[model samples]
Target: MSYYDVDAILTDAEKVPCQFELDVPYLGHLDNSAGLKPGTALSLPLWLAEMLALASAGEDARAPLTLNLPACLSEAVAAALKADPRAVALRDQSAHLYGVGVRMLDLFDERELGAVLRRTWAVRAADVGLHARKADEAVGGQGAEFLRGLEEWERALFRRGHEGVRRAREWMDRVKRS
Candidate 1:
């Protein structure tokens, strides 16, 4: 989530469902209308939505908007991940699925959702490591399908694991040569 991280920037660009809590005439263009109306729902990028949802008019006033979990983190997707993290194509859901989930988790308190996300990451990470260890053998079979479904973080993990295995083999080869 660093400021300069490309993946973090993309994560902030992921859109989430939001509802305006108050009408603001100047921001109408956001919703393709003359003026933004109260109760108006729109899909807004995480950055804009977070700012709007957290900005209050006064000490006792409510924020301008309410943020909802993005479609990628919907209940159905959670259920699918819970059932089988490997089966769900997270990349298809969002290239930054976990990032959006983390931001939403900060906005809302949903213990179950957090647990599901954590479990999903754990399961898929182990699979990615296994595939990395046997990268050559996995390139053409079922492993390719799973690898293709990985999101940004998982892809990095796979690359690191694969590199580690390659380096270890190279060291072993050098030892044998000596």
Candidate 2:
């Protein structure tokens, strides 16, 4: 089994265009869906997966999948990294030593990045004993490093000179806290 499945990304993006389009289906069913749920059929962002899981529990069948999933996911992954002081200390180290596939998006295309991230997720997921390993052996470290780096970048955007991203993060944080 390939460590990661491109079908995961495709399913997530295809069903919920840009996060905002993800609305509960009629009578709690996913209309226009291929019968895929967040955890089972797709590898959605962790936060999103949790959110859906929560919303699915309540009778309120109309929860909006926050449109800022990419940024939010980027932040969550960063938070996980920061939770461990050792990983936090790794901020700004070598690229491969840190968030390998994600931050490297600037160096490649969406398709390429997706492929790499899938394989990376697979490998790291396996390394950590979650799922199977992503087939592609990354040049440097595991795929989780990229997620950590993305989160770190998101954190720095708050503490760094990027006032807009910082403000946006603050507002989003407020909403999440509420």
Candidate 3:
């Protein structure tokens, strides 16, 4: 098994290699040896780390600041979301991760907006690694419930327009008014 930390949490070893199979040959005969090693577990993908690193910063490019993602696992941000858009669709419709995604949109500047968040249905490519790591922590426990909520969360944000994105629009509107 392999492990890494993201969003201030340690993810399971299995998720390190993007993903793996858990199907048991028989009902309970699952094999564990097939899991990846720490060596193969990926470091945070560069673009994503930079995204997180950038959002975590203050007004200065290099200032260390503290903030939190409203929800850490938007299906769009999910590493495997592209792999399973249907499942992601469900989660987006029912989870609060949507609200988080909305908030995250606020943190973006013209740079990330042009680079991420506009492709694959408001999904960002740079976020895949961190989201993949988060999926490992969520397969069981509150993960399922959190996702359940995420389905609704995303729905609300999309229906109403993401908070951050809306703020961006409002800011632009104000500038136009001025």
Candidate 4:
């Protein structure tokens, strides 16, 4: 079975686009998007923005999007990462490590990174038993509950990131056979 089914788990999250004022022209087509003029602000999904930003940086070191995360979300991430320091500390930075996976998967379209993170997250989650739940609870039910409690935008971010990770894993499996 798959470790996560983002569509099933993230049904409650909305898709919020990130706004980017292009410093340089985006020459490629994005999801049938057209008329990408330089100096014009374009709104894109976070995953797309992240990928474009990285790709643009490589070509011109220009930032495609002016990204800003909310302060409360930052606090929530910090709190979640610090929730059980003793347990978290002994486990070798799993909290921050897990947070990184969540953040990267949420923001980017780097399949290799996602695949690596998928494996690392699985190993760490298993080591910590992070998903223990009653039979009545769905797999990752706790995470879903926690996600539901987040602010709308935060929930969206988490959902998007998880979907990225899932796609990455699927891509890896399809291409890695030798």
Q: Best lDDT goes to which candidate?
A: 1
Worst 10 residues of 2 by lDDT: 127-136
- Tens-digit lDDT string for candidate 1 (62-112): 998999988999999999999999889999999999888888999899999
Name the better of 1 and 4 by TM-score: 1
lDDT at 80 for candidate 4? Answer: 43
Instruction: Give the worst 10-residue stretch by lDDT in candidate 4.
Output: 86-95
lDDT string, candidate 3, 1-178, tens digits: 1234242132111111111122223322122344433222222322343343355234644412223332344334454444643344444332333333443455543333333333434542223323334554455875455435344424344334434555776899999999
| Cα distance off (Å), candidate 2, residue 91 | 6.6
State in Å the error of residue 40, model 2: 2.8
Which model, 1 or 2, shows the larger TM-score?
Answer: 1
For each candidate in the order shown, give its overall lDDT on alpha carbons: 0.92, 0.39, 0.37, 0.43
Tell me the lDDT of model 1 at 172: 100
RMSD of 3: 17.6
Candidate 3: misplaced stretches above 4 Å? 1-64, 68-71, 74-77, 89-94, 109-150, 153-178
Reference-based TM-score, model 1: 0.96
Give the residue spans of candidate 1 off by over 4 A: none
* CA lDDT, candidate 4, residue 64: 62
Instruction: Please state the error at residue 122 of candidate 2 in Å.
Output: 30
Per-prediction backbone clash count: 0, 8, 15, 2
